[model samples]
Target: MNGSVTSQDLGEIFKPIVESFGCELWGIDFNNSGRSRLLRIYIDKTERPIDVKDCEKVSRQISGVLDVEETISGDYVLEVSSPGIDRPLFSIDQFKMYIGSKISLKSRIQKEGRRKFNGVLKKVDAQNIEVEVGKVDYVFPHSNIESANLISDY
Candidate 1:
């Protein structure tokens, strides 16, 4: 299935496998190298950090499943790791989880010729992510976000 399926489809296929391991599957990145490709699987715990052993175990399990099913062919590097400090805010739940924490966002369409915003994440409801920038509150639709990451501690 090397050329048959897109990464999105493969991600959908792998989501359950990762979730079954008691990890939230943050994202998957596939980078093609000259000799091999890098398949990085980012995962995390909802309430705590993941350790090296956790990553290794998930790696082994995922490797087995990938090898058997052949999601992507050719020599590849499979790396299972944590999402780190700037974990992505992919869903409303993720946004809610980080409320009261500082965040940065970029949208698909520019606003005032700027695509970025940095502020304390206020609220994340079914409709949007609320962020307070300066003295104003901005509501961003989850669908319009091109990228979002937790702001690192100073």
Candidate 2:
């Protein structure tokens, strides 16, 4: 099918399928080209970092399943790999996972003149994130966030 399926549905379909093989599904991006399509899967694991073989294995297996199921009914390339250093903050758990680390959060709501906030992740509550700014902590609602990612330290 359709990509309009619930996020939970897509997650359900991919989670077990990937984790069953001992891999964490990082992301799934379904997009269109001029007349073609692309299905990219980003994966992760604990031990040995994702190498070529790891990506190959996941790509091959996932490709086989997607091919037979025909969820994407068009010409597409399947790409699988690690999240690298700059991974997307997907959930509250993920945000919690990076507490104390630097992050860049952007939302529709404006504060001081922009929608971006750069600060340390102080806390990741249920529906909002508390970021320490100056002497005050600003709570940002998760639903209003357009995107969030870790700020690399180098």
TM-score of each: 0.75, 0.80
Model 1: per-residue Cα lDDT over 1-154, one tens digit each: 7744555776787788888878888886677556777888888887779999879888988899888988777888889899888876667777877889999998887776788999899888887888898988888888788778898996
All models: lDDT?
0.82, 0.77
By summed lDDT, the worst window of 10 consecutive residues in model 2 runs over 2-11
Clashes of each: 0, 0
- Model 2 spans with C-alpha error above 4 angstroms: 29-38, 73-77, 133-136
> Cα deviation of 31 in candidate 2 (Å)?
4.8
Per-residue error for 61 in candidate 1, Å, reads 2.2
lDDT of 2 by residue, 47-95 (tens): 8687888788877777787778776665766678787787767678889
RMSD of 2: 2.8
C-alpha lDDT of residue 23 in model 2: 87
Model 1, residue 55: displacement in angstroms? Answer: 0.9
